[model samples]
Structure formats: C-alpha cells, structure tokens
Target chain A: MDRILYGDNQFFAVNHISDAKSMEQSMKFKENDAIIATLDQAIEAGIDTFMCTTHDRIAFVCDAVRSNPEKYKDFKIYPCMPYAHKYANAVTELGIQGTIKQYVPGNFFGSMFKGGKALVSKDYLAIMELLVDAEMKMFEGVKTPVVFLQNVITDLLLGLGMDEILKGFHDYVREKYDVEPGFITMNLPKLAETLEGLGIENPIICASINSANFRMSGGKELYEETLRTKKIRVIAMQVLGGGAIPPKEALGYVCGLPNIESILFGASSKRNIDNTVSTIHEFDSK
Target chain B: MLRVALVGAGKMGLSHLSILGAHPNVEVVGVCDTSLIVMGALKKYTKFPCYKKFTKMLDQEKPDAVFVAVPTKLHYEMIKELLDRKIHVFAEKPFCLNPEQGSELARLAEEHNLVNQVGYHNKFIGTFKEVKRIIESGALGEIYHFTGEAYGPVVTKKKDSTWRSNPADGGGCLMDYASHVIDLLNHLISPVASAEGTLLKSIYSQHVDDAVYSLLKLESGETGVLSVNWSDDTYRKMSTSVSITGTEGKIISDASELKVFVKKEGALDGYTKGWNVKYVTQLTDQVDFYLRGEEYSAQIDYFVNAALKKGPNDINTFKSAARTDNAIALIKNNSKTKA
Candidate 1:
C-alpha cells in the first residue's frame, strides 16, 4: 500500500455524516467522466494508488485507466471484495444462482460445478475466492498489488467466528492473485488478534484511526495498544471521523500514532486531496 | 396436518401464505415481518397471529415447518436457526447469499432429515415441466445448445428504498429475475459446465443490475445463453422463455406454451414430432386453488406432502439450488474476468 491511497467512497455515495451529501456526491459522480476527472486531479497531486470498492461503476473507471495507460501507467488499485451491496442487489435481482453465475469466474459449467461443490461441501473458502475473483474482474490488466476485504463481510465473518475464512482470504490473495491480502474492520484490535491466531504475521489491516473515535469499535486505546504491539501494517481510515475532526488536527492525531504505514481517505475535489496530502506530509515531517 | 409459519410478508411471502392458508393438509400457524404495517395488513386477511419477531412466532406457534420469503441476505441465519430447531424449511429462490451458507443449511437439513425446497416455481410450471419431460424422454435428442431469457418491468426508473434495490440486502435484477432463468436452464438443459461473455449491467438502479447477458457451456457437451432485463418496460408482464436445439428436435417454451419441432414423427406424448405446440393450460396440473399458476400451489403442496413423508421428498433440494448458485458463481466470475 502507498503512504497515501485515494479512496472511492466519494464516487460511490458513501457519507458517514450526512445522507444528503452522500446523495449529492452519488449524483455528481454518476458519470464516469466526473470520476475520472477527480482521479486525474488526485494523480496531478502525486497520489496515484487508489483503494476502491469493487462497485460496478469502478469497472468503467478501470476502463478509463486502462485506455489511457500513459496517464495511469504508475497508478495502482486495491480492490475490496464482496462489495456487500453489489452482492445483495445482485442476489435480489439475479437470485443466488444467477448472482453467482454472473460473478463467478471460469467457464459456466466448471464454475458452477465448483460453486455447487463449494455449496454442498461447505467449502466457503472457495466461494470467498470466487467472490474475490469476481470483484477483481474490473481491475483486469490493471495493477492491483493489494486486495482487501470490505468491513461489511469482514465484521460479519468476524462476528460469525469465521476467522478461518479471513486466513483463507489472505492465503488465496497471496497465492492466487499474488497481492498482499488486507482486511478492513471496525474492530482493529480484534481483527489483528484473529489474524495472528491464524499465524498471519504482520497482516495488513485497515480501520478507523481518528481522535474522535467515530465508528471505531473496541475504543481508541485498544487500537493504539494493538498497533504498537501487533507488528502488523496499519492503514488509518476515517481519520476525520466522517468530518467530525478537522483535517490538520485529525492528521496530527493519527500521524502521531505508531505503526500506521499508510493513510486512506476519499475526497471529491483537488483542493481537499491536495490539502489532505500536504497536511499529512507536514505532520509527518514534524 | 403439518403446521407452518411464514417469515417475510412481502410479495413472495404473501403468495406462499395464500396457498398455505388454503391447503387442507397444512395449518397456517402465524406470519412474521419486521414491519407492523405489513403485519397489520396481513392480519386483516387471516386469523393466524402476526408478529414482528420471527423467534417469537416460532416459539409461540411451534410450527412443524417454516416458509421463508425474506431477502437473500436473511436466508442463511434465519433458515439455519429454523433448521437447528428441527423445522422443515421451504425458502424462496437464491437459496442463500453464497454457496457456503447454502451448503451449511443443506447439511443441517440433511442431518435433521428435514424436507427442504427452494421456490423455483418455474420448475413447477406445466410447460417447463413438460419441456423437462420431453427432453428427458429423449424427444430433444442429443441436445447441443439452449437459451434462457427473462424480461420484466420491475426497475425501469429510480427504485424506491427497498431490499430489492439494496446490494447489502441482496437485491438486484441478476439475483431476482435472472435466477429464475438460470434455474430453468439448470432444470431443462444440462448443468452449466462453464460460462463466458457475461455482463451484469445496471441501467436505472445505481446498486442493482437491470440487465444481464451470459454465454454458457454445460457439462454434458451443450452450450447455453442467458439474457435478462428487469427494466424492460416494453413487456406487458414478466416473460420467461427457454429455447433448446438438439439433433432430433427443438423446443421453445414460454409461460403459456411449449413449441416443439422434431425431425421425425415418433409417438411420444401423442405428438406428430413436427412443430407441435402445447398450451400451458393443457399441461397444467388440475388444482383446487389457483393463483398466478398452479406451480406455486404445486410447489407448496409438494413440500408439505414431502414434509409429511406422504411422497418422495424431491422437489428442488438445497443441493439442486446450490447447483444454480454454482452456475451463477461461474457466470458472474466469467463476466468479471472478461470485463
């Protein structure tokens, strides 16, 4: 992961604080051109690594990046999987079978048989891999060095006592996709502990690391303790607490923390991106 | 009489409730939904108690079986809990969100020896069933290729905030409508061996897909194509059809009719073997209660009967639905790779 990775939350209508703003952003970025323009702006400011959800629209963005290779030649994407909402909407419309058929990789029969076998044999790891591959489909021919699981399925699986799937994900991404597997969770400390239990040393985990502790489960103190002691890579997100914390103050608080190798944030404008990037640089130098 | 409780009071749930209520061999113990407004409206029609919580309904009713028509995301946990309590389950399509949950539930059902069925009512449609029979009887000999299509006018515009449009809630045209077509393909043709050239496009809804297209290869040396669009307002109603081509004949089927074209005349089901057309009404099962089609009632009756061990417990097992899930997984994966 890059020291500063651009996120896709702004393009996908995700607002932690206001639904109205989220809706507005969704409408604004509904067009691929708008999204590309913003990405280009970020690139102009020297932030090239994009940590994005595997939303359907991102496929169009990937197309933009692939077609203009010179523009994004050094750019990279970190795809998050099971874009829960994508799967949910897909299942709602296409049904489970159709959803799987639509997203699962390989020829129809082989993938179906693999899916069927996974279903019958309870080989959820295979299903998880299928979903990961499906989500990564858009990033084909694009550079994806880090693939992470979204917090939706991450926390769900964590709560379900299905940490083995997490380990399986880590291994699958490493072996099959040849990318570092990252896990995003609301409970950073717990996820770290779970990953360690599976013998995943120094795992890459992304979570909320902010002064306000907005949406940070298990509190701030535990996260700091885990970061200091866990020997894992940390990507601090929601550093602004969904806009509750000011940019400079939030960056100062998080940049001062230990073991945070990277910072992930989403901004729709060049000013916000430049300001956030510069602020982090200023705080880091201090 | 087997006592049954219903979870989810939405469109499909209500449909199940209607048939379950009228069945003489079954008792509708209760209905449950998260919405008081929906439960209230449902309460007006039936004396069966309504509750907001499923656990309370289950504890109070102690129904022998549960019919789940909830969202796909809710299927795994709810069905797992019911199966844990040794309750038979007949859930609506898309069995579970993914194969893992489907497998777990299937294993639970098998371990409990409970009768389980997924609501692939298209399999119960007379013309489709006839299509299956014709193919199984070697009428469409040495089948080589098939195509399944489903079109409707569900999400032509911006959809309301419902589970049907929310991806987190497992709502999308690919899952909702295309699942039927995929299941039909699994039932009539051979199981999908591989799929390519797949696309899941969203025209109107931001989250859910409105259109899907796929090219598939079946395990039995056959090929398939699936094209579905839930946002197609040009169609008056939801139309699902399948066309199969083989060495001996071809069968084209829709909701109301099955058209067969054979290379030679052979006495199979009293057909001349050349361009034989059969209306769904002619092939449909005679039933006491009919709403939409007898397939709904037929599927329900089959589950209820199978639950009571009065007949073979083979409708559409979770394993079978899991096969559809498998095919879907392949199609989705193929589409993504190609994209």
Candidate 2:
C-alpha cells in the first residue's frame, strides 16, 4: 500500500458536507482534462495511488492515464468494484434481466446464455465474478496493484452472514487479477473478524478512522482493539470525520494509530491537497 | 427477542432483512418472497425459514412483527393482513398508492393498538435530524420560506418497460422520488396544505413523469417550492436537501451536513452570528448493524425499541406517511387542474 492514496469522491458530486460545494466540484471536473490536472498535482505532491470507484466516468480517466504512459509511469489505481449507484439505478430502471444484458461482459449472446444459467442456479458467486469482470474492463493494461470491494456490498455481505462471497471475491480477484484484494466497510472490527473466521488472515481493510468515531460503526474502541490485536493492514479513510474535525487534529489522530498502513483522502484544490500531505508528513516525522 | 418475518425479497426488502437479521433484539423466524430464486438462496445460506406465499408464511411462522417491503400496490393488502392478525408492522415508504387505503390502515393499526411504522429512513439521518431539532429550537425564527429538492440519475435513458413506468405500481418521480422530499418537509417544517402551479414533466418515460415542479403552501400559511427530478444524470445518486429561511436565521441541510446562518450573536446556542456548519458524523449515533447507511439500521432499531417499550406511534407512523400520501395527492390534483 502507498503511504498516501488519493481518492475520487471529489471528482464525482459526492460531498459529505454540502451539496452546493458538490455542484461546484461537478462543474470544476466536468472534463477529463481537469481531473487529469488534479491527479498531476497529487503526483507532484508525491502520492502515487488513486483509489477510486468504478463509475462510468472513470473509464475516461483510465484512458487518459493509459495513453500518457510517460507522465503516469508509476501511477497506480486501486479500483473499487460495483460502483453501487450504477447497479442500483440499472436494477430499478432496467430490471434484473435487462441489467444483466446491459452490464454483463463478453459476447452479448454468450452473456445472455450465462446470465440465464447463473440466474437459474442462483449462483451468486458466478454473477459476482461476471460483474467484477465487467467493471474491471476499464482498468485493463493500467497499473492496478490492489482492488477493493466497495463498502455497500462489503457491509451487505457482512450483515447477510455470507462470508463465502467475501472469500470468493478475494480468491477470484487474486487468482485472475493477481493483485491484493481489499475490503471497505463501515464496521472494521466485524469485517476483520468475519474475514478471520473465513480462514483468511491479514486482509487489507479500509474504513472510517477518526477520533470522533463518525460513521465508525460499533464505535471507536472496537476498531482500536481490533487494530491492537488483529493481523490486518488498514487504510484509514474519512480521517477528517466528514469534514467535522480539523485536518491537523484529524491527521494527528489517524497517523498516531497503530496498524494503519496508509491514509486515503480526496480534495478539489491543490492547496488543500498539499496541506494534507504536509500534515501527514509532519506527524510521521515525530 | 422479538420474532420477526419479512415479505418481498426485492432490493429494499433485502436491505431491511440484512439489518434485522443481525439485530440483537430480533429473531428472524421466516422470510416470504415471490421469487423462488431468492427464497432458495436465503434457505441455503442463512438459518431463517423461507416460504413462497405470504399467507402460508404468516400461518406457519406466526411472527410477532412483520416487515412489508413489497411494491406500493401490494402494501395495503399485506399490511392490513398483518394489522388484522394483531402483529406489529413496518411497511416501506410512499406507504400506499391510494391515500384512502393508507388512512384506513393507519386507523386499523390504531384500533388494534399494534405497533405500526412506515419506513422513511431520512428522518434517522443525523444532518436532517439536526435540521428538525434546530427548527424546533426556534433557531430559524418565524420560518417564512422553504424549499425541498431532490435529484437522481435513475431514469437517464429510455429502456424496456418496468414497474417504474407503471402508475399502478406507484412509480414515477412524484410517488417514488418527490414523496421523500414532501415527507421531510412535513416532518421538519410543516405539512403541505395546498399546491398550485404544478408541472409534472416527463424527460424519458412515456407513461410516467420523470420530474416534479410545484409551488406549495403549508398549513401555517407559509409557502415553498418543491423541485425534484429523477432523470438528472448530473447527480450520481439521489440527493435530497432542504432549505429554510426565516426572520432571524436560515438553514440548509442534506443527509450528511447542516449549514446555519443566524442574524444575531445569541440567536442559537453554539451558533455564531455568521454561518455555522455541522456534519453528520458528530450528530449521528452508532448502529449495531450497518448496511448502505446508518439511517437504515437506525430506523429499524428505533422500530424494534418502540415495539419493545410499547411506545407511542409518533415517528414515521402510518399516520405520518398518510399525511405525505395526502400531499402527493394534492400535487397530482394541482397538476391536473393546471393542465
């Protein structure tokens, strides 16, 4: 894992604080060129990894990075799967069969055949892998060292008591993509325990890790206890506690924690990005 | 532990089942769905009993409470049956396609003295919850104007026919999308008394409206605007927000954050004369089981606790949802009158 990973929530209209700011960011990154410029600023600030969701617009970002190999030679993208809202909207508008026809990869006739068979047998793992392959097509030939399961599906599976699907995703991604598999969740402690129970040890998990325990399901102590005794590498996210805690205090809390291998953050401005990097560096130096 | 069962294994149903299945105070006895595929998967994967028919499941499992997550067209029959059996019930939002059926069911629940709730999960969101609290504190004194808006990318392109394009299924921007905003308005501010200058526009659907625009008058004699569009591809997901202006201050909030601007220094406690911003992180409480968002699990836990304590049917009750349903009726009627 990189010491610092840039996120893509700001590129999309996802803001935890205000919708007005989100609309402003949506206009600011309306074109791929603007998003590439921001990525360049992150690279100039010494961050090398971009952890992003597999939204349709991200395909353009991947194209820009793949075409300019020299400029982004060492840049890596940590792709997160299923892009949630894509499937949600598709399912609502297109229904199940139509959604499969629209999103399942490979030849149309072949996907239809396999989709029907998968639906018949209720082979959820098969459908999951097909969707994973569909979502991963954009990242082809790009440097992707790690793939993450988005928290929507991760937390759903955790609550559903379907630990096998989590294991299935991990094994398939590792065997096919040959990259480390990661899971993002709101409840880090339960997911760590669930993974360990499935005989999978030392997994990579990213979650909200702040002193305020904002969106930290089950609270802060369980997460801290898990980090102290568990054998999992963590990527601390939402370190600013949904923009409530100040950056210095937020970074201080996260960087001082044990077992946190990296911090993931997204910012729309160069000044904010540079400030976060310096704050992390300052805390690390101590 | 309270014995619980769920009907309809669709998207929202599955989300509710996942949360309730892990709840400490609940024991999931049976799950009934029309899809044999979903039932078979649940029976194979989890320990809960699965059934094909709701009536059969009700007879065999005899649960103390039931969660009705079927389409709006099916809510009346399912919830009525549950209330008749003296079982507590929690039904999904836009409670029923017909407002009269919703009111009758609300009356039935009250007559039977059973715990009844309609799921309007936004009320449990911290930022929006804070919006209600601030308004109640008179922080925004003499509330004069408000706006409730929501947009999403649900119907960005034309596709084959589904339940969304069917009015009988309680589908469209008004029932499916705008109802959320209207419910929030009723909960946080005042219930809408009338609507005029209404426009229901169809962007991509042939049979249903994709956008809803209307001018609303609250029962308190104040007015506001209701603007909602589900065909907006600019937004990645559903973004619903509320803004209120008053004599002393103003407030703007979505599910994740809250913003307030006061005119005086001592207008509200902990709020300066200038703008004060608050995030959901500090305002939200922890949930035992989380999926999609904290609001989902929080609402379920609230219902469970309410049932356990035999508390008043005050929050998100069928009565409240029926109020929202009445507001939807007013909007539809206003559109017809204008046309």
Best prediction by lDDT: 2
Relative to the true structure, candidate 2 has a C-alpha RMSD (angstroms) of 2.3
TM-score of chain A of 2: 0.94
Report the Cα lDDT for candidate 2: 0.88
Q: Model 1, chain B: what is the TM-score? A: 0.96
> What tens-digit string does per-residue lDDT give for candidate 1 at A10-122?
98877655444665896798789999899989999889899988877889888988898897889999888766665654544555455666676666435445533323223
Expressed as tens digits, the lDDT of each residue in B94-183 for candidate 1 is 887777778778888999999999999898887889888988899777888788999876776774556778766767877778988988
- What's model 1's lDDT at A173? 93
Task: Supply candidate 1's per-residue lDDT for B249.
Answer: 90
Question: What are the chain B TM-scores of all models?
Answer: 0.96, 0.98
Candidate 1 versus the native: TM-score?
A: 0.54
lDDT of each prediction vs. the true structure? 0.79, 0.88
Query: What's the DockQ for every one of the candidates?
Result: 0.01, 0.53
lDDT of 2 by residue, A1-286 (tens): 8899999999987887677778899999999889989988999999999999999888988998889999889999999987888788777876655676678665543643554332433466777788888889999989999999999889877877777788989999999999999999988988999999998979999998998887788888888999999999999999987677899999999999999999999998899999999999999999
